[model samples]
Target: MLDDFMTRATLAGVGTALAAAPLGCFVVWRRMAYFGDATAHAAILGVALSLAFSMPIFVGAMIVALVMAAAVTLLTGRGYAMDTLLGVMAHSALAFGLVAVSFLSGVRIDLMAYLFGDILSVSHVDLAVIWGGALLVVALVAWRWSALLTATLNPDLARAAGIDPRREQLVLTLALAVVVAVAIKVVGVLLITAMLIIPAATARPFARTPEAMAAFAVVLAMVAAWIGLQTSYQFDTPTGPTIVCVVAVMFAVSSIASTLRRAG
Candidate 1:
């Protein structure tokens, strides 16, 4: 029999993987990997705010992540480069969050858990939040799929097709924020972006279509979660980083295979 806690952890891991896969594909498609980093970094600030306010971390992270994303969206193409802007926001938010957490001597929270992860410590309540948030994101993405794809291809083309590209962009931004907030418990702030990128990237070579890529990403992410959990359990390793390591190894293998195939 699976240990009860391990069972919850597995469910949580699989839920997070399902959420990350489709959204990660969009992140890869739109070249918004840096944006994921920035939003996730802002999650640290959310942690500070949640501690200060005595509210749920999910609410705090979601608010701050959305703000960070919106701030970037507004600043984009307005005489500022995306990479520079995201880098500034990402590091600044992280630094500020660290500083803020330090000032909160009145409360006690483990900073390392927020920075790295504490997936093994997840509870039933956390599972509810994780699954709820993940399903919401999946539904929202599915609803906006066509328009989002069109807008991602070309804002002008989307506009010409009577689709508001800005709206679609907002939809994606909102979804990304949700991912940032909910994923904090699973991979924490530092590794969230990796969970968002690596699986989709690993699946890229085997995919012949967009849908196929997403399916492959989901499968690969789930497999990584299972393997990562087992390896971490056996080795007494960090669950979150171990999962990312598994995904990274898969990516390496896929890259090598693709290279050899091309060479042949």
Candidate 2:
């Protein structure tokens, strides 16, 4: 039974890593770390809503994430600094979510689980949700990969080519919403951004092109997930943070290697 549980956990972790890897590339490319954080932080509000409504936690989280994305897009369209707006929304949503969760009369919510995740507890149903959401996100991204890349690399160029940058931004935001919803269970709100950023950041040093970078990021994320899981098992530590720490270590190593290569 122990082995079975570990196997299941490992599979779930890999699936999450695969899904996060590609989207994470876009997050890094566009410098959307703050946006990712804002979306993930708003997930706490989704958790609160799920508890209150007795809905699936992922559903609540996805809805709130999409709403937050829309709000951010609108705010930015009105000329607000994206980082500043994201920061405000991130902290405000987190605070409101905490307060909202506290108002529940019965059934105490595990704060740690929402913040840092409880990967070992992922059910078969949860796996289905993760994979399904991931497929949709990957499909959407693949279908629009060129346009998205063009918009990210040069919005003016994409616009001149008749690709609406605003529309692509919306698509990216929606993709991010799905990613946050699926990943919340794997890495929780606090570490989800790390999963999205670190792998892509690490891959940057090795990639010769944007496509290679994205693919490398996915591979790194998967490796990190496996190594982190093994380490968690060996050390009897929390899986989500452990995985994030592994990804961080990979980023550090990649940074050093990149610096040395440049120097040499």
lDDT values for all models: 0.92, 0.90
Task: Show model 1 residue runs off by greater than 4 Å.
Answer: 1-3
lDDT of 1 by residue, 2-21 (tens): 35888988888898998889
lDDT of 2 by residue, 80-147 (tens): 77778899999999999999999998867889988998888888888888888888888998999999
Please give the clash total of every predicted structure, in order. Answer: 0, 0
Model 2: worst 10 consecutive residues (lDDT sum): 1-10
Clashing pairs in 1: none
Regions more than 4 Å wrong, model 2: 1-3, 77-79
Top candidate, metric lDDT: 1
> What's model 1's lDDT at 129?
91
lDDT of 1: 0.92
